[model samples]
Target: MKKLYNIALCYQGITEDKSKVSNYITYIEDFKAQIKYIINLGYRLVFPKEFYNWYKNNNFLKQDICMIRFEGGLKSIMPAIVWLIENKLFFGISIIASREKSGVPEEGYLSWDELNGILGSGFCEIISHSYNLKNFDLAKQGNNIISVPVLELPAYFDNGLNLYLKGDSVPYFDRTIVESAKAFPIIGTDINTNNLIKSSIQFITPKSFDGVLLRLWACLAYPVSTGYNAQIRVSINQEEVYSGDFNAISYPGNIQWPEMEFVTINFNKEFYFEQGKKYNIEFETLNIGNSSFRVYAINNGDNNIILKTSFLNGDNLDGLVPCIIIGDGSGSSWTLEQYSNYVNRDCEQFRGATNKYLKYKKDITQYAYPYGAYLANKDGNSISSVLTDVLSKNGFLGGFTVYPSRIYDNRESEYIIPSIAVYGNRSNDIILNNISAYIGQLFEEIDLKNIIWQGILGYDEEDFVESNKLNIIGVTKIENYKKKYKSQLLFKDIDLEEVRNQDLSVIVNGYDGININCNTNADLNYIVDLSNMFKRYRKKLELTINIKIFDTQMTNFSFINFFNILNNCFLFNFKVINNNKNNFSNSVDSLIKIVNNICTTKEKQKIMISYNTDSIFNQSNNISELSLNEAIIKAIQLGVKIQSDNIDYFYTANNISCFMNTSNGLNKLSNKIKQNGLGGISLY
Candidate 1:
């Protein structure tokens, strides 16, 4: 026993003249022919509903069962139902009817009673196409033209309705007649040529079924109009399928009669059509006025063939090529990963099947997997849900968030906070911002200041210098400057012997004075050692540093070198002292001047500076109270403020005083500087 699959043959019937053949004769002929073809092919025909139920239960014999669907009007389907029941061919069938004319009183041919009688027989099922096949396109183009009642009005100038002095009732046949008829409800009246013209026109053709195979298919028809000398031409596959002209002939008395004439063209020949192949249908019209046209192609056939062909040919699903999937973790739930995998898998399956059944040879290309794990959480809770929800609200996808689990320690649970992760793609920033806004809504109670953020500071490729050269230049120049000024400085020639010989016990008793007296050579040496230690301490307190290469041009190589220098400087806890001197007001002045100069230079735009508290506390207001080393650091921070061209180059200072106090104790407290109110970076 071969497994049988159910197949449904769907067909639609349309009339160029619905009034002339208002019964089901035309549809019955086509349906009977379709049924006979299926039976001849050794398949049993069954109704659609029964076939569905049978397939759901037993999966139907793959090659033995088929179903037929006749889609059109009730008038066209009623006769087929009678024929099926009378013949005792209790096979399954479904009827789809146009809802618009179904309830109309059938004229002499088939009344509404007869139509219902056939449907009540239960031989066929009825499906609605639509309440009315609305043609908004025609209504929009018609622009308030009235329809007339041409069929009911008399033909001559009799007592019924008259037009003019010529004793002709032609005025009754004008637009007014059609408009007046349209005003009345069309319940039981007979549809005439004029009525059909007023309503929307639907064109049908044999090639309509080719939509299953062709990438492009269209229908063309000239709508009803009062225009003179109008024609419509249509062609399929470069061959003319339809062409016709319309004209309103005027009788002798300077009077006009409104009439509608129509012609239809259909492609009857079979042509090998394939998916993704370019197909063209051209429409041309001339000598028409104030008229509109519409074309529609109804497709009902086996589309699996086209889908399969496209799959085998590697014509990506709907023309979207698969791309790489980035980020970590399982790709199961990621839509991007899933979509890409589906395409790749389909291609692979197609290749395997082709090799076995069609002997076709093809190589499967591998796609690259994405990098990084989608951080599930940066803190304790899953941030994925929050991030995803935020992205959805903002109408964007593909934004990333740093997972709490990836970066934070469980011990720091209280401080664990998710920071919005931004990708390298600039196009996704707005979406990420929206996501940030959404996350803000959920954690409204938490202080944003407690959260820590990580961001990359991109360097300008051109401004970067080689690390070795930059270090050599900066060190050599500073050394040279120091050598040139060493003798002229005030502190260089101070006599140590005389000061060390004097007693210093009295000064030691006070908290404000220097603790060691320098009266002897040993005491002087001690003082110098203490100053050196303080210098080292100040170096450690410098949080931000900048280097300027005057002669160097910014380039990729230069930036690489600059970054290397920055990393080394940060590691060694040393600040690069700027040697620029012309702009100095005090020790702090020299640093500030250099900072301002660097900020103004376009080549050094990527340089960044962060504040260290020791340096910030040594500004001019507190300089008198600071030791020599403390003043140096305070000058550095002030210099940064003076020279910074934009706030983007500044990094916020982190308070590490608590850690310092715990590690070093009271001796460290003596040197602590108080922070004065200074406005930092603006958050907004």
Candidate 2:
């Protein structure tokens, strides 16, 4: 009897994974280098199907072969797999057979065409890793039950009742074909079982609109991890609308954090909104496994935009790739604990596998057998949940509370700071002050604080500023400054430690405008250079950026470039000002939408919902107060919170327009903001 010695050592990403983004394939190059090194040790490469074929034909290993198993997905991992297939060596391959077949294909999963491409070569054969690649978790939210998705797939469509895609719906993971799994292959056995399972799709139309309805969508969830195919059918008013495969995956047990994804259906025709009309949507599921899913959430009304289309590209490979060992006669009855031995033993299969090819290498592989086999605990009693943790272990004090005292009389004014004075270079300086004074007068008539700012707005023509320069002289008591400036100016105290070359470092917030122009470019490089040269001597200098939508000069290429470069760079409480008054409410709405399109939900924190009150809200105390209703005010506040974890409402005491002058308008706005969950407000 001839003895067989074939070693297949694999390091799967899903086994020892490290990534921040759930659905992104991050360190593939690093993994490729290490895996290829092991293969060059004179061992042959084999895949799942090849292994099964060998077990059927060769019975036991008689030749030197190394098998490489990869999880299934189309374009998400095509580039790397394509490169491997083009290699001269014969290698085995595999993918998760569970993918969308009926409804619109979910983004990032393997498509049929990509799978065919993988199987196109005689050297490769794909094995079934799983059927419904999900580890289901169902929990009751009060009385209703909800389940997180099996795979960590970030979605694009944000659907809700009375909400839909407002514009032309964008398609992603488009024009891709994928293979559907017919049956599941059990591990450690040659048995294959054909399964037929069923599920459902739930769809909702947001509102009645006379315009063209762009998109219809529903979320899909898979509970079983079998490698069987699933399909879904959708209908509106009992009429079949879409019937296709569920965009499911295999071996969902490998995913660390899974997110449910929405399947998109394009409805490009106009539809009428019914005040009392009911639209019925139905979803039917067909599967070979006992796998099931839940589709919820009904949306209608206005549409929304999902930016950052590249997420659909699939460069970020997610999902799990399993590793199984065969060949030995005792491999069949391996216990659950013994599987770890297979993981450890295969890692030891490194014998003649490393020879002259290893001559160029100086480093040795660190053996940590069975690494990352344990389940991680990121939810349920995490570190963030600990409340009674120690804070002072140094033996100073415990069980005590203290705060800084504002009653301190010691004043430190020995430092020689430069004086602040305005250099009236522009003829618009005096006119600017007059406009500011009038706005202040208007605020005085209202019940709110009379304080505003001259946000440093940029211009196209040689950096035209709305106000003059800010020359700092010295520091004084906060109350003294309030007495001196009255309701004319409001400014935030900034830390000047990071400021270097600038001549003026410190300036009191005069509650007035202090606009400046950088007649230069708006590129990131330009901003860096400007910061390096003209440093502001303050920390937490949240500059209020100006937006002039209709101003042709404001649309200068440079100004637009600054914004284009930093699309998602706004803080939660980001400050922006608009001087337009003609369409005050509409202007605010549009600006909020812009912020929504540019930022991600996670990135939105501590947002500031500000109303510049320039010329738009400039009305009599009573009139401006009544212009907007309670619902509108609450909507403004809710909008900010929807896009951010934290939010606040800010209104300038004075601006180009004295809209705050409306007697109770600003006060009512403040109250409504609080009612709608705005965190804080700036008092003039």
Candidate 3:
């Protein structure tokens, strides 16, 4: 039996001329034909409740399921709903709650009572589209034209580097004034022609300020009594800003430390330095007479604070850059604060919608981003973690974006599930054919091997796949497993010579998993470079990544973002470890929920739940032995596999014929596993 495909089809109005938006709006006759055509294709129309329930339960259906979603909660959609009710079909409506209060007939918006009536029919499942879709759309586009009252001051970051409030001023001096004993040659007139120094420091302007000034500590190595005619020039982006005779410069001495003398070179003319723009400050000094000056380079730890510092002639003192200070401009900070406040208020409106939906006894668990906009600001930055956090808090399990793809195995996040747009501009044949093509494409892409068709919906694993032999056997040490299992082995430490001699099929981590520290930028860059490498490689090699969560309380969003970066790079196999507490079910349940929330449905099937037999049997006397077996079986049925270190535990504890040593036990265990459609496991 072919595995059934899940398709979520969304439509707008049923009327031909309901609104100006013709993208999703289909005529009444056209929608009727589309439904009939879908029904003819052996598709079962499910309400949102049923669809989400099936998805949450990990219940893959044997027959294709179609979820009909209507947007805007328009009155014109009601006529189609009547036809759906008469035909005994199920559908969902995404309501713009703000429009419901107005209940404008000309606008085609439905009243709350009307929506409740449709809900009572048991044919319609309602979800919040948004509080005010219009305003949300405008705000997402970086417009400040919102009807709702907004916060006065919003939190803004300092040039997208530091988070700051409205009152917080941008730091004048970027790095700490740590003076180094060593000095670089800035002006050496006493020496040869090569002694002329050219030094430059490039910095990204942290914020818009009144004036720009470059200050660095400089001391005369050899002071000339007379005829000190050295020319000193300061240029901003190659344009000269300051020029003077070296002897004419006034050096201010520190009160406590007289040797810590510094020269402040103020620009002769005020140059407008835009916020976030990189500017180069060049200091060129030529020797005309006998005068020698050396600039004291400061050793600052923060390399990111100031971008780059270079000395052409001397040692490349990377982080030891000059100090740049800007004049105070708190007013400009307030302008940035206003924009931040506007964006926050827009996010707050999402929460407002969640609150309003509770009045109708409907908790919105899903969101369809208006206009399919996922960006938080006008500049297309990374997908808004702030916005996703808000939606996650508001009970949104996931949101859909019209990215024109099937719900892929490697998705961005639960917040950015891709959906294909079905425009009413096309004919019913074309729309239905397009959906069919998507299903076919998905089947070809996510090709499940040895599938058992008849038992697709049942927890009986036999209905999913037909395989008695283990596909992958993983071990910490290959020498032990290779001599025993004698087949495909995934190893942490691979012996290339042993592999060649034994003719063993070995799976090694694409990027040595042990070396990865996801928290560090260097490790992340390594993964990125590897991804690009794999993308460019001509031949396909099986790429596998191993991720162990040592810190259970670690922030998941960072991991989510990391996985998003490696979305198409590799397939992840999860090995769930049950600690010595003997509470295996809790660990299994928690990991399952985490995987479900983080991974797409297709990826979920690829996940393998590994159990350390030592942890479970260490205190097996007090453990719920039967419950452990049940938990393992449940995980297997949910498309998760169990890889135990000891194969004897299943035979001894559960009294099952799973002992690999005996042919009867191995055959029975393998049959049970094949029948249940469990993802292949590894026994170390």
Highest TM-score against the true fold, candidate: 3
Candidate 2 residue-wise lDDT, 163-230, digit = tens = 32234332221111112211111111111222332212222334443422222212232332222344
Q: What stretches of model 2 exceed 4 Å from their correct place?
A: 1-28, 53-64, 89-104, 129-135, 138-684
RMSD of 1: 32.5
Tell me the tens digit of each residue's lDDT in model 1 across 160-189. Answer: 101111232422122212211111110111
Best-matching candidate per lDDT: 3
Ranking by TM-score: 3, 2, 1
Model-by-model lDDT, in order?
0.26, 0.29, 0.46
Residue range with the least summed lDDT across 10 consecutive positions in model 1: 656-665
Candidate 1 vs candidate 2, lDDT winner: 2
Tens digit of lDDT per residue, candidate 3, span 285-359?
Answer: 755555455555555444543323222434455565443333321112324444444444544665675355434
lDDT of 3: 0.46
Listed in order, each prediction's TM-score against the native is 0.21, 0.22, 0.37
